[model samples]
Target: MTDLALLQALGALCVEAGRAILDVYDAEAIVVRSKDDRSPVTDADERAEEILHAVLAKLFPGVTVIAEEAASRDGAPTEAPETFLLVDPLDGTREFINRNGEFTVNVGLISRRAPVLGCVHAPALGATWIGAAGRGAFKAEAAIRDVPAPAAYRPIAVRQRPAAGLCAVASRSHADAETEAFLEKLGVVERRSAGSSLKFCLVAEAAADVYPRFGPTMEWDTAAGHAVLAAAGGAVTRPDMTPFDYGKAEAGFRNGGFVAWGARD
Candidate 1:
């Protein structure tokens, strides 16, 4: 399929997955469990993953999918193919548990060790971001069961760095001293805290100028948002200023520290 078509399909699937999440989110009691890795998991995560897996199977046929819940259950592959899909059915589980409306459904397509297309949907916030390498990025206000037409989405891009000062975004749930020190070194004048992959979206939309993540993150955690930010004319790199790419199956798909910038510095 074309990149644009794949992005649209992923967006729709993420929206559907978001609906499943909301169903569990609205329940009187949300049951949570600990994964083998000691991370939190919920019915919302599994249910949404089920939906994404089923739809993706029918849509893509033979493509490999490395989803968070599944990987947590069945150990991750030691090596990945040149192309695959990375999925985090429900990102920011803490935020979801807190009912902060900051969690998201993420689907990203990785090709040649890079995110070529992605879609992120925050159901509670009624927002979605979709992007592809050559097709650019877009944002839409799509509520439950509301799939906005392609034209309804407004194109989005990162802005030039402000001459006055830089604005930075940090994870609300997983802040670390390294990230703080990095931001301080960058001389960021303003800082915003957010949950899930919204930090990448913030920079992608020019709401913030940078997001430095020093804590551990999985490929699924950042791939979708990374795609969006890159498509919006931004970049994600290692703290040392090296390129950031995916398909790190050797390390159980774990990610090292990285910095996301609205514009190249």
Candidate 2:
């Protein structure tokens, strides 16, 4: 999967997973379950993961998967796998519960501890962002096939920070006190709210300059957007400014606070 062609193919697999999610979403409410972490899961998550697993099993038969919906303390292999896909079918069930149109379908492909390809689809919002290392990153918003069109793809980069004012996105429902303190410290002139991975997409598009996640979020929650943000000329860094890496030996599949931006590296 190191080759450019292989990366692109993996991206297409991500898109297919998105479509599977939309199918589940378009149907009526399905069963919702609680994981050990007590996070919510709908039929959408399982169906999408199943679809992705089936496709990748054929495309990259030996590639292991570490999807959020499929993981638990019960059955994780004893050894860490080298390459895998981290999938999040419904990123904001809370938003989906409120019918706020903020959830997304995300898929990330990682090799050697870094995201090489990723795709995120917001069926309700009709937006899709896709990225691959070196080949560049792109987003699409169109109705045709409800899918992204390659011809319309444009390379994205983070906008330079404004000297006088900066805009940032806080979680619409989870804008905690620390997020407020951080935004206030950043001296943002205005603030917007979005749900799910849309927060990261906002920064990637330069619609907003930054998103600081001081709250809890798993690896699946950020991995795809991390790739997109990085591809869009932005980065995700810890409070110490060290870039978050995937495929850690001890961390399993978790994430920590980081910022996303649209600016020069």
Identify the candidate with maximal lDDT. Answer: 1
Q: How badly does each model clash, as a count of residue pairs?
A: 0, 3
Q: Write the per-residue lDDT of candidate 2 for residues 3-91, one digit (tens) a residue.
A: 44444455556556667666656667656778787877777777777777787677667877777766753444445577877777778
The TM-score, computed over Cα atoms with residue i paired to residue i, of candidate 2 is 0.88
Query: Residues 195-214, candidate 1, lDDT per residue (tens digit)?
Result: 99999999999999999998
lDDT for model 1: 0.91
Show model 2 residue runs off by greater than 4 Å: 1-15, 27-30, 59-61, 73-78
Position 62, candidate 2: lDDT: 80
- CA deviation > 4 Å runs, candidate 1: none
Taken over the whole model, the C-alpha lDDT of each candidate is 0.91, 0.74
lDDT of 1 at 111: 94
Residue-pair clashes, model 1: 0
Question: Native-vs-model 2 lDDT?
Answer: 0.74
TM-scores of the models, in the given order? 0.97, 0.88
